[model samples]
Target: MKKKKGDKTMKNLKKKLMYSIAVSTLLLGTTIGVFASWSGQINVQPPGWGGSVVSWSGVTKTSNSSKFAISGIKESNSLDPYAQLVNSNAAAKSSWCAIRQGQTTSVNDNTGVANYIYYTRCKTNNLEPNSNIISYSFNPY
Candidate 1:
């Protein structure tokens, strides 16, 4: 077959396009992986005078390796705060307690996959009426 004048140019252009696309895809994947994170807050108020309250927040992260920090404030000192990281099946993967005011409590799960996190506040030794407003923020990476 006789070689056409534009055939070589067209072949070169096609190769360049494919290479550009491959490089773009690799860069996009790396960017997303490096800057992926999720954060939220939860508030719980117990109805009774001496019971516990629990609230849950969910995330879309799919990695088995995860780290999270939870911090919160309580209206009363009698209420103790707790945080937990759970998997997609609602199983407890890791848990932390004694979340103090103005401080953060963190948990790192390298082997257990997590999809949800929850916070709890339990009233202890306080016979007074329950008028506690507990709020917690969850940050996961």
Candidate 2:
């Protein structure tokens, strides 16, 4: 029994339509899967295995006669870190060195008190270790 030409053409068209639908579905699924796994935060860790500053509570100032206290948190403390204080009027620097990580520590005023105090968060350069400051504020108090 010979099949009619119109019936054969219709079957071919249906097969092509089914193939197109399957390919389209596969591509759409792939695109959606790729977008679903994205994370919003950038990695700022300094070539190490730890995360960047989780939170900063800001600098606090306290004064008692000639002595002053400046304190804050450096949550991801990986190296030699300090809370540094500078008096702009008197040209003096007071640094509280080797503070325990994630703890509130005070940098005392070794020199006489000045009109303004500049607080800085700094760490020793991992490569040089004792050479220079890794991070500090340009402005002083």
Task: List per-candidate RMSD values in Å.
Answer: 5.7, 19.2
List runs of model 2 lying over 4 Å from the truth. Answer: 1-72, 89-91, 112-115, 125-141
List, residue by residue over 1-28, the lDDT tens digit for candidate 1: 9989799999999999999999999999
Instruction: Kindly give the stretch of ten consecutive residues in candidate 1 with the minimal lDDT sum.
Output: 116-125
What is the TM-score (0 to 1) of candidate 1? Answer: 0.49
Error of 1 at 138 (Å): 1.1
Root mean square deviation (Cα) for candidate 2: 19.2
Which predicted model would earn the best TM-score?
A: 1
Residue by residue across 58-129, what tens digits does model 2's lDDT show? 222222333333233332434544434444332345644443433434444445333333333344334422
Q: How close to the true structure is residue 90 of candidate 1, measured as C-alpha lDDT? A: 46
Q: Candidate 2 at residue 50, lDDT? A: 21
TM-score of 2: 0.33
